[model samples]
Target chain A: MTPHDDTQQAQTRAAQEPIAISERELTVMTAHLEEAHQATLPVMHDAIADWDERLRSENDPAELAEMRARFGRPSRRGFLIGAGATLGGLVLAACSSSDGKKSSGPATTNTKAAAGGGLATDLKIAALAAALENTAVATYQAGINAATAGKLGTVPPAIVTFATTVQQQHKDHAAAWNAIITGAGKPAVTGVDTTVNDGVVQPAFAQVTDVAGLAKLALSLEDAAGATYLSVIPVVSDPGGVKTVATIQPVEMQHAAILNFVLGQYPVPNAFAKTDGARTLTDKIG
Target chain B: MTIDEQELAELTSRSRDVHNDAMRETREPLSEIVEVGREHRAHDEIDPLAGREFAKQRNLQLGKRVGLLGGVGIGAALLGLFDQPAFADKPSDIQMLQTSASIEVLAIAAYTAVLGLPFAGSLPAVVQTFVTTTKDQHMQHLQAFNAAATALGGKAQSMADPVLAKVVEAAKPGLTGPGPVLDLAIELENTAAETYVANTGALEDENAKKVTASIMGVEAQHVSVLLAVQALLSGGLVDQIALPPPNLSALPAAAGGVGFPNAFYKTDLARAADEGAVK
Candidate 1:
């Protein structure tokens, strides 16, 4: 393609899928990295008396509950609630509606009923993951859109390429989860988790006048995504489900590491990834 | 609770058939809700692959493949080593964990050698710091793998990967500088990453999968960082690898994408789960 054509193509691509790159994005998440790294390694298995005793006792509630608290129960406020806990910045929870009543905002309206009314725990995890991936896809698109609109100013070609690849990977991760959902005779989760969209992401996007601002949001986003994946692989029952999540977890982490580097921080901050801000099953899907 | 005996048997059956097929097919183990919580028999002497006759056959075969890839005499020598019952066509959680520990052993050894290079003390502070940190991380990974294995009633492997140890041993003399050293380090990281990736899909235990997958992410991160550092070194921006990189914009564009060349990390080049298992 000619230079003009290349520029037009780049512009079109950027408009379609924007990811603003900046140190601002990197800084938003580092505040939590120190605490996350310092988390005590949970050798939880050591707590069990024996395999048969542990397996036989549904009474064995402690480990499961301990783990579930790490990733479960999404609400419109939960996205930023977790991020606020981790990133140490920006409370974006939805509170007042246009008419001044306590309202759920536009987020709660898009909710689809849990597939078939209830899904298996593995399937629930899959659905929750699909929505998170969908939210990520939209998040990157918003960044690209902001950059293309000249709001972020002089978006670098390298940043565009980074956004493009990272966005596509999120798309793939969504598809993998959806495949499992659909294969199990459920509807594919086709919408972004509304809680993240309205409560956290939209507000964050409006504030991102520069690449760093947008990148900061994206970095926090990937940190949670990677952590959630780690949280579930141990308890997510299906081997296929574990494999699918396992493959994607590292990609999210790589994204975070690079962002950390861009932000002038240590790349791999934790010896092992932590679940401090991981998402569990969202109310969006059973 | 637990997986029913019939279902567990079916899973075992399915895994066996897959193992029989040249060990090329992916074997899905029993659902691990029961596996991870299952107690490791204290002092259990049971061999993980005792009954799977073809595991020995596959070992001989993998040894052949290694010989083909590395031009070594391993294939011909494998049978003599497995005359005992320790070998099998199927790798249980123990063998996989042992193999992982072995790789970690080799990695720590490689990094130690890198630190001991005659000029190592004078290497860039960032390179030296990275070498030291990564070695420590590998040591941690080794402990995690051995702990997981012993938890599952298996002996821990304390030796370096016999095959890759040879490769690293041969590559040692050329550890003369960052370029060659990083190249070997990347290979080891990729192999570790990819092997763990495959292990997540193959291992029978949920905790094993979780542990393997988490380590895989870090190993892949090592690859990403190493690749970025390699790019900086190649561009002759040696000073740029410094933590809190000297100047972000002054860095080359390759720095952006070099770290993650692929969108999805694959297991195509993954080392076999049994390649380094202690016999």
Candidate 2:
């Protein structure tokens, strides 16, 4: 860091004042800063400056465009990140800034950050979780609908049941999260324009034909969903919330087993452990 | 200054217009964007190892925002297939379907090659059935991938990586023997499962997630089948049915649901680990 670098850095920081810092940088900064709770804005501004420079210099124009489309929204990603940091009190002031536009000024303390703590009150995390669940539900329903529409074979009753049931569970989870957000008196998540477009879903549905393929697809989805929930569960504060997520989590494993069973892949001859095992701890902490 | 109710309302109205203008001018529909990926060349000398390294470089270039929206993992996966630009983007549902199909093709090649192993001659009836069924599923997976990709106007690659497919073909006879072939099969199955698992998080499209899940299920069965064959070879009790191993259960629920933990870990580190024997 030369004096020139420092001056450039300062100028860059000034320019990035209002833009949100990304999650990765927030993590790094969170580790670097002692969480004194002051001077947080500088770190975010610096991150934004760096992010803007990087995006400007990126070789892949398409990727950059995608980012602009997805994260350019001001509060969607940025506010969500702020909410996440504040709720956890982790000082990782991640600003996801979904709207692509850069905000002006140095980072300013906001009411959302002031409202941090407890599982129920954390609007950011709740909103994110709800959004994620809603997306999954929407995605799965779309997949099922597309699969049925393909008419390759009779959409097995079991396949229909699995997709519908799991989707319902996701819906319920989203509702529960919404309830929590409401109880906290925060606005529930307002969705983005990223609807479950049929163009995306129809092709995935085309990948399977028989009951086994359908079962297999369902099992894989549940596994992914289950893993996502598991990764977040430890970070979540509400025991009730944790339990709710956990209960939903195992259903994914069970779904995997059911698919395996249908495909004649189930139960170890020697072991009693339910197959379709969840990811191990070493998989994460390692 | 914070946008108060009135300012906020005014800005919101204005922002919509800006967004509309932007959309009209800059929004390339997904189909067009996907075409860019599809039309991109598969670099002749590219390997998964090189691909992974390329991703690391790209992510480094991407800066802090790398992990913000959906995170850097997708970037990493995209990098893994550096040779295949089509597979590199934050995989769409159609892309996922293609990848899953590619994996199935890989699995079929792997399983079919395994049959030529001397070990195949000595396998028990049940174990053989497992292998046979796994091969069948891979074929099914191939069909699924083709149908999905073709439907979406994307051509599914014959096999995602030619080197791995060639290796499977070349290694078939030698791998026919029990210890080496079984281990190789197990490793291949794990690798495929890991690939699907990794893709689960990397993809943003809902359809992609579903397709990735379908591939994962196939991989799990491959695991089950391989495990049964291994158990049978060892004269150990085989499972009543092949089942997906519980490797992902250990991850806490936040990162991924428990079932998908670190599915990307080994793939993420495979080259450094000298684990890319598939080549």
| Interface C-alpha root-mean-square deviation, candidates in order | 14.8, 22.5
lDDT, model 1, position A136: 86
Q: How well is candidate 2 docked (DockQ)?
A: 0.02
lDDT of model 1 at position A40 = 11
In terms of docking quality, how is candidate 1 classified? Answer: incorrect
CA shift at A55, candidate 2, in angstroms? Answer: 22
What TM-scores do the predictions have? 0.68, 0.36
**All models, DockQ values?**
0.15, 0.02
True contacts kept of each: 0.35, 0.02
Model 2 chain B: worst 10 consecutive residues (lDDT sum): B269-278
Off by over 4 Å in 1: A1-119, A283-286, B1-91
Tens digits of lDDT, candidate 2, A117-149: 333123344554555555556555445544444
